[model samples]
Target: MDQGLAGLIGAVVGITGALGAAYLAGRGQREQWRVQLRRDTYGQFLARTKRAERAGKAVRLAMDSGRFEPGLYATFAAAVAEAEESLALVLLEGPWSVASSAEDVVRHLDGWRWVVELWYDGDGTLTLERALESAGRDEDRFTQELEQFTNEVRRLLHGRDHTLTARLAYRLAARHSA
Candidate 1:
């Protein structure tokens, strides 16, 4: 082979390798950004949930102990509001499975908050005991759903596929809709 042709071939290979590496590097950085964004959104959601949960617990304790502080309900409402705000990120960025679970968690949390609010806002018809019991049940269900959501997120972060149950349900729902 001619020396000039050999040098040209070597240069071409080197340039091709550089381009390939750059493409791969760019792809890897994009993936990392996505992962970081997911983690941040998940963390925000979980943090807000925990804050709301704490406020709810405080309200429950107050109700159970027959002491109604003026600001406790407001605090719980604020926490729930913060949580709902954070939920938008989850809905926007999460995978379908994670988004769905996050939605369920938010719904359950809202349901619990609504029940608590009703006890406070109603025309004095709801018994405290009954309201507490119902709220307790809702909170329990919310906690369970949140735990499941957290686990789903963990699986997603680790690059696991959706659970079989989720896939089956999605397929069944799609089939029914069709």
Candidate 2:
């Protein structure tokens, strides 16, 4: 074999190897966005749930203080809306179960929104204590369902690991008294 030809062949093989390496690296890098998105979706889910819970608390506090301010209450209502949007996006993005779970999130946020709105804009028709009681009950039910929904998402995404569920619980628990 000619020495020059051998060297040429060796160079080609080296170039091909480099290209293959680059291709694989690019593939892995692409998945980095997926991993980050998944993380963001989960983080948003937790944040939204916590925000909804806080909004409910705010409603209770406002009613107790007898302060009727629609704009102030709207902030909490807006959080519920933001939470709904995040859930919707998560459903649209991936892992399939986001659809079902995100629906649950939307439903819960919707019900919770009323309570926030009631705090500021509710007519004198219904008794504050009664309405607050009803909202609290709804929150309890939705919280249970949200836990289940997120658990399902976690099960689908993480298999046996319950990291998503745990994080959500930790956030809710931390804010329980708040």
Q: Against the true structure, whose TM-score is highest? A: 1
Q: 25-110 in candidate 2: lDDT tens per residue? A: 99999878777787788778767877777766776677678875666567777877787778766776766665676677668667
Candidate 1 on 51-147: residue-level lDDT in tens?
A: 8988888898999999978599999989999999999999999799989999888888898889888999988888999999999998888877777
How many angstroms is residue 164 displaced in model 1 relative to the true structure, after the best TM-score fit? 18
How do the predictions measure up, each by TM-score? 0.87, 0.71
Judged by whole-model lDDT over C-alpha atoms, candidate 1 comes out at: 0.86
Q: How close is candidate 2 to the true structure, as a TM-score?
A: 0.71
TM-score of 1: 0.87
Model 1 lDDT, residue 49, Cα:
86
Who wins the lDDT comparison? Answer: 1
